[model samples]
Target: MRETVRWRNAVFAVFFAMGFGFASLAARFPTARDALDISVDQLGLALLGISIGSIAGLSTASHVVARLGTRAVVSVGVVVVGVGLAIAGWGVEARSMAVLVVGLVVTGLANGITDVAMNLSGAANERALAKPIMPIFHAFFSFGTVAGAGFGALGEATGLGMGPQMTIVLVAIGALSVVVRPRLVEQPIQPEDHVGFRERLSVWTDARTWLIGGLVLGMALTEGSANDWLALLMVDGHDFDPVGAALAFALFLTAMTAGRLAGVPLIERFGRVAMLRATGALAAVGLVLVIVVDDQVVALVGTALWGLGASLGFPIGMSAAADDARMATARVGAVATIGYVAFLAGPPMLGFLGEHLGLRDAMWVVLAFVLLSLATSAVAREPRTASGAPDPAAEVRP
Candidate 1:
C-alpha cells in the first residue's frame, strides 16, 4: 500500500508537470499572437502544428512505451516539453512565426507522448489501488493549470514577456521531473503482451474503442477549445482587456479543478454514465450562456459551468479505455489519437469560423459535439466479468 501510494504520488507529479507546461503556453497565447503580429485565423493555422506533432506522437506512443517503459518515456517527454518551451519563448522574442510553429509542434509531440505514458501509469495505479482515483489525478492537472494561468497573469501584469515567463516555468518543471522520475514504477510491457505489428494495428476494428474515442473527441474539443480560445474570445467577443481575459481563463481552470476534485464522489455514487450525462447537459447550457448572453457576469458563470461540465469527460474516457488491462495501452493510444483529432481540427476550424461568423458564434460548433457525447455515455459503462455479469469489483469508489 505504501508503495502504491508512492507510485500514485509520482504519477500525480508527472500529470501536474504536463498540465503546467501546456498551460504555460496556453496562458501566453495572446502574447504569442501579438509578438508574431498575426490575425486570429493565422494563429489558428499555426496552432495546427501542435495537432500535427501530437498526432505523430500519439500514433507511436503505445509502441514506444512497450519498448522503453513508462518511466523512460515520461522522462524524455519532460525534457522535450522543456526544450519546446524554450524554443517557443525564443520564437516570441525573435518575433518569428516560423520558429513559433516549430516550437509548438515539438511541444505538442511531447505533450502527446507524456499524455499516453502517464495515463497508462495512472490506470495501472488505479487498478492496484482499487479505487476511482483517475478523477483525482486529472484534478491535479487542473490545479497545475490554475497555478500556471495565475502565474502567467501575474507575469503579464508585471510586464514580463513570454520568454522570461516560460523560462522560469521550464526550469521549475525540469526540476520536478528529475525528482519524480526515479520513483515511477518500472512496469515494462510483458513478453506475452507483445504482439506482431499487424495485430497491434487491429484495435481500430473495435466499435467500442471508436465509441469511447468519439466521446473523448467531444470532450477534448470542449476542453481544448476553451483552453485555446476562451481568453481570446473574451478579448475579441466581449471587449475585455488582457488582464480581465486572463482572470476569466483562470476562473475557468479553477472551476474545472473544483469539479474534478468533487467528481470522484459523484462518480462513485452515480456511476460514469449517469455522471457524464448530467455534466454533459450542464456544459451544453454553459456554452449557450457564454455565446448568447450579453452580460459579462453571466458569461463568466457560463464559463464556470462549462469547465465543470468538461472536467470529467476526458478522464472518464481514459478510464473506460483502460478497463481491460490486457489491451489498455493500445486502446488508450487509439482513443487518444481519435480524440486529439478534435484538438488538431478545432483551432483552425474555429479560427476560420471566427474570422467569418465572429468568435462567439464560432463556439456554437461545440454544442453538436457535446450532444454527441451525451448520446454515447452508455459506452463508458463498467466492463463485465467472466460470467457476463457486471463486475461490481470493477466499479470504482472513492
Candidate 2:
C-alpha cells in the first residue's frame, strides 16, 4: 500500500515535470520565430520537426519500453528532453533554423517516448489503487504547464534571453528527474511475453482500439486547438487586447485543470462511457457558443466550457486503452499515437482552414470531431469478462 502511494506521487511528479518543460519551450515560440526572422508559414513548417520526431518516437515506444522498462525509458527520456531544451535555446540565440528544427525534433522525440512510458506507469498505479486516479495525474500536468508558463512570462518581463532562460529551466528539470527516477515503479516484462515488432502491431487490428483512438483524437484535437489558437481567437474574433486575450486563455487553462482535478470521482460514479458522452456534448455546446455568438463575454464563457469539456477525454481514453494488462503497452502506444497525431497536426490544419473560412468558421471542423468523439465514446467502456461483468481484474492489472 505504501509503495502504491509512493508510485502514485512519483507519477504525479513525472507528469508535472513533463508539462513544465514542454510549456517552457512552447511559451518561447513567438520569440523564436521573431529571432529567426521567419514568416508564420515558415515557422509552421519548422514546427513540423516536432511532429516528425514524435511520430518516430511513438512508433517505437513499445519496443523501447519492453527493453528498458518504463522507469528507465522515462528517466532517460526526461534527461534527453533537457538536452533538447538547451539545444533549442542555442538555436534561438543563434537564429539558426536548421539547429532549431533539430532541437525541436529531439525534444518531440523525447516527449513522445516519455509520454507513453509515464502514462503506462500511471495506468499501472491506477490498477494498484483500484480507483479512477488518471485524471488527477493529468491535473498535475496542467499545474506544471501553468507554472512553466509563469516562469516563461517572468523571463519575458525581465528581458531574459531565450537561451539563458531555457538553459536555467532545463537544468532544473533534469536535476528533478534524477530525484524522480527511483520513485517510478517497475513493470517487468517476462522474456516470453516480449514480442517482436510484427506481433506488437496486432493491436492495430482491433476495432475497439481504433474506436478508442477515434475518441482520443477528437478530444485531443479539441484541447490542442485551444492551446494553439485560443488567444488568437479572442483577439481576432472578440477584439480583445493582448493582455485580455492572454487572460482568456488562462481562464481556459484554469477551467481545464479544475475539470481534471474533479473528474475521477465523477468518472467513478458515472462510469467512462456516460462521462465521455457528457463531456463531448459539453465541448460541442462550448464550440457552438464560440462559433455562433458574437459577444465577447459569451465567447469567454464558451472557452471555459470548452476547456472543462475537453479535460477528461485524454486521460479517460488512456485508461481505456490500457484496459487489458497483457496488451497495455501496444494498445496504449497505438491509441496515443493516434491522439498525438491529432494534437500535433490539428492546429496547422485549422490554420489552413482558418485562412479560407476565418477562425470562427474553422471551428466547425472541431465540432465535427467532437461529435465523432461523442459517437465513439461507447468504445471506452471497460471490456466485459467471462461472466459478462466488467473485468474487475483488468482494471487492477493495468
Which candidate number would show the highest lDDT if scored against the true structure? 1
Cα lDDT of model 1 by residue, 46-149, tens digit: 88988898998999988888878899998779878878877887788999988888988998899888889988888878777888899999999998888888
Off by over 4 Å in 2: 34-39, 188-192, 386-388, 396-398
TM-score list, all predictions: 0.96, 0.91
Error of 2 at 195 (Å): 3.9
Q: What RMSD does each model have against the real structure?
A: 1.8, 2.4
**Model 1 vs. true fold: TM:** 0.96
What local distance difference test score does each model get?
0.86, 0.80
What is the TM-score of candidate 2?
Answer: 0.91
lDDT by residue (tens digit), candidate 2, 1-398: 98889888988988888777766666556566568987544665666777777878888898889878999998889888877877887898998999888987998799889889998898888877887688999998888776766666566557688788878878888888888888888863223465677877999999988999999999988987776666657766778764466566667777788989988888767778888888888889999999999999999899889988988999999988887777889888999899888757875677666655677888899999999999899888877788888776664443
